[model samples]
Target: MKESSATLRDLRPTQFAVGMIHVRRKMAETRAVCADSRYAFMEQRAIAVVRGPGGVLHVIDHHHWARAWIELGIERAPVQVKMDFRDLDDIDFLAAMMERGWVHPFNERGEKVDIGTLPPSIAQMPDDPYQSLAAFLRIARVFENPGEFNAKFAWADYLREHVSGDSGTIEGFAEMLATAFRFAHTPEARALPGYRPEAAR
Candidate 1:
């Protein structure tokens, strides 16, 4: 319930993995969009965080942006507190976050992980290739809604089931993306977030 600016180093990530491709994309954008002044760019993008046990600020969104700032050696960004669960114990705090869709404690392979093992910071979060694919799918305007919390992660889970054999190369990602794009339009994907059934035709 508070909004303020905070140093990037202090913002803890709520997930164990991020689409590294997406992070790299943001990195490139940082140089292009905010090259003149990172601070000014940050002022325009305020990430959302929830106060957890011991008053830790857990990032709920814009995980890529936070990583970009730290990698670019930028110091801080504006953060808006969406909730305060500090009064709850560690277990209860995490439960609240998950219930509110504020935390996604899944790994690259779309496996559920203990929330306690969430990356200590955004910089340490590992890569989730399917996550990258899901993000690009969103950008392609291939679906609808796209508003629920962690919706992209939901797509990531779906992609993980339909696509496989990631070589972790750009070319490999392109191949996977092509396949995923097709699978995205199928009836099975209709249940996922941001599904525009008409887009299939």
Candidate 2:
């Protein structure tokens, strides 16, 4: 449960879903590197996991990177155990995780989900297109991280209200980006974790 290697397939996902576009982008980037280079790349970014009840490993961060590794057919990746909550029961364990912002119990539609029902692995995480939109907004510098856990997700939750559907094309994502930008600066969005009014200019 320390700094060591683990099977990518065996690591449990703390969240129910992720921005698959982000995961796909990482997959493409990782695929471009040579085998040895990819090994070094992953080595440098060892995934951080938390040892939960029954000694289950739950990824706390870098979900995109972890997903990319598995999708690329890499068998193993380095992981570090940041916390050990195996002593706590399920209820107490979840509470402790939330207290430290280590769990994401949200799903594809941005609705809160039960952590017990989360996907067994990142490979199975459903796509939250709105989650992708929130990510794209950050990449475009339209949404800046407010130094909080799941900041993009908070924005995604708000975007879920006004945006829906994905055409699954470059042009379509661009259009969605445009639509999201209009609301990214609105007074209502000001309450979101990544809200920044000055960036409206």
Candidate 3:
């Protein structure tokens, strides 16, 4: 079956209800896709990090892609809608982002010295622990690109269990995640996946 990125608004009431039922069934079958592992070293503690000055970070798995509750005077059933990644043109979204100056292209990771430069307490690692965790999570299929995203939070929680200490690692790990997300949300960075600078704007 082909996947589509069509939003819930695109579906009629009957189609939306049926899609929601299917989605709910799928969600109920899996508890956690990215965060669970039998390997003792792969565990991570869940910590809420502030995104903006007052905004809290919310991590939702790619599942639950469509369907949001609509409230009307405290009476509402969640409006269930179906969506598929295939429905979206990744290239178009990337192009739009670049024009808005939300990303920078061709910047190598090595050039970003500020990325891994957290304070000591927040930067503790088990000798390239991020790499190890990335490998583990990759095998478990936690993230699409292990190298693209840092696994410091998982590593820190694992360290805390074995090392028996509070190194304040979570804060620094959160910052690292924040940085990655910032880059992704940027205009140039977003273009990497779908836009060709020489061909189009």
Candidate 4:
């Protein structure tokens, strides 16, 4: 099968986390929240973004290309977003491969077989991997373990240390993009795309 277009590595830092939040919220709204849904999966794939010369982002189905669009009030509105998870098959295959390694292959007799090095059963990928990852990090914090999230932050800090003191517009712009995506446009808007109000009962 082809590669997934919504893998975690394909997502930017902010987009990665926000995507998890979005999926979680959507599951809740759609009344699809289940024991298995608690953990969202991030399929391996590519995501892209189309931007103009001025760094002004454009709208397109970059779901298979980039993490998410970070519209910084460019055109004529407060802010806009276009996130796409156009593929899921690749992710499933990779996840299965990660655990069993022989999800799809031919043997000497041309028969399907499980000869992967890893275990046979792969854990369900998290429905909201970012949120699940964050929660796990928090649990680590509570247990006095090394902070997984903070480690990433520290890495960023280290990178900044070697850079010049005068940060430019792109940095600020990216930060703004992250800030806007973190919060919901409105309370009603917080509902995920497929969420349903009647499911609460």
Candidate 5:
């Protein structure tokens, strides 16, 4: 319940794939939110982080919002320490995080990588276009919200097999979303999280 402000540069990402953060889209949304004083309550929804050894604040979620805060030139934002693993040694801490499903080591290629290779900062995270697609599809109700456990990665992996190419433009992404939306209800996507049965559609 104890919350405080931390500089955007001080947070560390627990995962490798930033594919969910469409920079332009997130930045635009963040700008709008910050521009309005009425929405100042967002400051109360702090980024969830854990206190790691050496006083590192490992971010557990909200990677996109944190990145957008940085992109929008916001110096510091609110944070809540969901856990404090600073008591554990590095090995134990990482093991605990993995066991609890709090850490994801997969890279942009969706290949599991060494946790040590995770980016040092939000800015260093790599873009995964499929992440964006997955989030968009969920928002568009192409499928239900994939629950938090590696949800974006699961959708991204599902999309990687069916969709191709990456474009930052709205038109290009709209086309891809259309393709992904159609594929969402097919048998191929049945195994994916929140997959809708064709009969249910």
Candidate 6:
């Protein structure tokens, strides 16, 4: 239950981008918050990690925050070890992680790729435009909070279908988001993550 300080370089991102825009915005916010003498950066801990084989600390969540910290030149941060899979065989460990929804094998293209294809560091994670769209949708309350494992991934996949490109400029993103917001309310989005029928809401 105790938190341990870890070098940001040593933590492995479990999934791909949560949205680079989200990471950049968080980096700015984190810097502002940490600038206040009354606020301690260490108090904002990255969530649980699993000590995988060969002593690699695999981050299960807070990927956006972690990426932001790295981009902000943060070398160390507090992390909690939720489980240690180092003792298990590699196959069993990976299986366990998948079973617990701790790993996402999808790439930025929204295609299910090999889990081995995952980036060894947060810096290498790709930018998925759908991730940005999903973040915007969440903020706009286009759908209720999914509360499901990898819910963002679900939203990302949904947004991917409506979006023509996998990447975009700031202006392009604004336009895409506006379109995504509209799409989220339609019957087409009913099967998406956290979709709530108008009557249900």
Off by over 4 Å in 4: 1-63, 66-169, 194-201
- The alpha-carbon deviation from the true structure for residue 98 of candidate 6, after best TM-score superposition, in angstroms, is 0.8
- lDDT (Cα, tens digit) per residue for candidate 3, span 1-201: 222122222222101011232233334433234324411211121111112111211111121222211101111112212222233354653354345432222111112233123212111211232222223333333333334333323332333233322213656544543443333334543333322233322
Clash pairs, model 2 backbone = none
User: Candidate 6 local accuracy as lDDT?
Assistant: 0.77
lDDT by residue (1-201, candidate 5, tens digit) is: 588889889899998967544655767766666356613644655788999998899998878778877777888888888888888999999988888788988888788998889999987888888888887876666567545565666888888888875457768877888888777777777777776564336
Instruction: Give the 10-residue window scoring lowest on summed lDDT in candidate 1.
Output: 142-151
Tens digits of per-residue lDDT for model 2, 34-153: 876877788778999988899988899888899888888888998989899899998998899899888888878777877788999878988887878888788877667766566887
- Listed per candidate, the RMSD to the true structure in angstroms reads 1.9, 2.1, 20.6, 21.6, 2.4, 2.5
Which candidate do you rate higher for TM-score, 1 or 6?
1
lDDT of 4: 0.27
Better of 4 and 5 by TM-score: 5
Regions of model 2 farther than 4 Å from truth: none
For model 1 the TM-score comes to 0.90
lDDT-best of 1 and 6: 1
TM-scores for candidates 1 onward, in order: 0.90, 0.89, 0.19, 0.16, 0.88, 0.88
- Give the lowest summed-lDDT range of ten residues in model 4: 69-78
Deviation from native of the Cα of residue 138 in model 6, angstroms: 1.6
Cα displacement (angstroms), candidate 3, residue 187, comes to 1.1
Note the Cα lDDT for every prediction shown.
0.82, 0.83, 0.27, 0.27, 0.78, 0.77
Judged by lDDT, which candidate is best?
Answer: 2
3 or 6: which has the higher TM-score? 6
lDDT per residue, candidate 4, 20-130, as tens digits?
A: 333333334334434354223222112222222233332222221122211111111111223222343545434533353222232212234443422121111112222
Q: Provide backbone clash counts, one per model.
A: 1, 0, 10, 15, 1, 0
